[model samples]
Target: MELLKLHLIALFLLPTSTLGFNKCNFPAIFNFGDSNSDTGGLSAAFGQAPPPNGATFFHSPSGRYCDGRLLIDFIAESVGLPYLDAFLDSMGTNFRHGCNFATAGSTIRRQNTTIWQSGYSPISLDVQYLQFSDFITRSQNFREKGVFQNLFPEEDYFSRALYTFDIGQNDLTAGYKLNMSTEEVKAYVPDVLGQLSHVIKLIYGQGGRTVWVHNTGPVGCLPYVMDRFLVTAAQIDKHGCSSPYNDVSQYFNLKLRELVLQLREELPAAAITYVDVYAVKYSLISQAKKLGFENPFVACCGHGGKYNYNRFIKCGSKTVVNGTETVLAVSCKDPSTRISWDGTHFTEAANRWIFDQVVGGAFSDPPVSLKFACNKMNTSQK
Candidate 1:
């Protein structure tokens, strides 16, 4: 009877070319981003501050800019993977599956001037890919295995594993806030796109075939900007999302789509998919009323009001004396009720729902459908 059971198990495990089996075979994820995808990694590198950064949930700062998980966390969950540890974290080096390289306040460009207050200097998308190259080399050496050994023992991991890049908001924000000339901004954009293209080439050069590249989002509408500019309540749309920001976001998204399409043509072997976070996030905000999100624009943490985040006052500061005015803010009753955990980041709930659209369904655009992107690589594996 035991022999029969073993035979049955072997029969069930026999390799088949079904899409479900192919989809389930993808091994791991490699991620890059700013605070949007950071998961307590920066804190591991920079240490944490009290009262402000993590006052809501972790009771102390946890590297992540938000009270809890970020978008990367949700994306990993959607794909049946563990919460990826920051590649920089001490415990992360041994993990074979996923490694996140996002840092809080990071932009697509290294020296983003927009939010200097956050003490954030992005790893730039170029640097991010360069680091990926280094990571591959080191991973091969440390494990004493070929680069693709753990990634794809069956020669299919490269095709099966997920690759995600979430960046660009910082680039647009820096360009606009720094008052860079239009020609300068326009010229700089191609360089940035060129850098992105180069990064895609590097990944493809290293055998990365399936990737999900996220475009920029509505930065102008962020509470930080709204409060800084003192935008009128009426200027904000019904969803409390600012229109100008959304418009700019749309433009950036359009350009990004064009760039990725070009990369696809250039790197024919890669199956790159574009995730339109702008539309996904916008649709989420539009449905906030029905989803029971009380304050789509209001931040769950930090000082509240028009700004939600006081760029001047700074969160977790002791500037306010006992007799002084209330400067420090509190988190909301239920963080789930809000779409934003801070003035600039998304709530866990919002992240999960958006992940559902991009990773869990057909909302992903270009290159090839995500389903094709993930499975195509495996099918081509030799």
Candidate 2:
């Protein structure tokens, strides 16, 4: 309880950016990934979807899966930029440097099926990178013509852009839910990583040198997975992350870190940083009582008792009528206070806290050591 108070105090004081740290080296950020890092690009595409999650904050679903902002938003702000608008948003095109290509429920592959069959655009990461290449080409041509109408000139804009990739949760979760054995799942992991590597290479080819690659988090701890897989509630731990799932996540992260090092050696010009978001996140949840959080596994959304979820239904949908199998969840009274708003994503407030830690360099080894390679370009121009 004493610790929970400290955590709460941190929350209250967190927004002021008073934690005293070096400012972000990158001038702008370009984000790509699934719901974790997405800024509502997917939600907007699903137009006419009744007041989505962002309804509470924006008075409508502003494309973000959360009530407001995700990790990318805070990261942008930390560096003195507005939250990056999704690439598809009209206002998003106005942002100078960054654009979010991440769509909710997206993956690196075409065929991997997950819990939410509402699979994002048929385009995989490979196609997404191709799209990115096209955008870069367009931006360059626009700049050469002196049409500074876009956010910034091509040189300064793309050079300073920080590329962030946080995805793969859905792919892993999908495999597990299908009852695949550990070895079978492990076999598929390499393919996923290979796709990630290909994307990284594509970005490097596009003159993006500052890459922040995020590995999978503790997928086992998610409420839906825990409730479905764990035999006893006691197995859910203090923070609600399932132990077995976390174990697999750790294994993945370990391998991912090694992979990042290999990628760095391959693309020496880029500033590559490996992020262990899971470790930092786990720390906060480990002492949840001190952080003023109860039932980390229990989603703020969902209906019904216990899990408040069904494999067949989604949140906010009228799945049940007349006490039948409805959406099976209810959003919390104040989503801002809850760590998690749904079975798979964190609330906006929670996301901010996580960003604060990462920006403060909590998740990286040897701290935030990546320098802006673009700085050299800037000096050369002078």
Best candidate (score: TM-score):
2
**What is the overall TM-score of model 1 with all chains considered together?**
0.80
**What TM-scores do the predictions have?**
0.80, 0.82
What does candidate 1's lDDT look like per residue over 268-341, in tens digits? Answer: 76667777677677776777777678657677776656547766555554455777855466566677678877
How do the residues 218-337 of candidate 2 rate in per-residue lDDT, one tens digit apiece?
Answer: 777676676666546565555556776777777777777777777867876876777778866776567655667666656676665465555445456665577786444457777755
Give the TM-score (vs. native) of candidate 2: 0.82
Deviation (Å) of 215 in candidate 2: 2.3
Off by over 4 Å in 2: 1-25, 48-52, 90-92, 112-121, 143-148, 151-153, 228-239, 311-313, 319-329, 369-382
State in Å the error of residue 213, model 2: 1.9
Worst 10 residues of 1 by lDDT: 373-382
Cα lDDT of candidate 1 equals 0.65
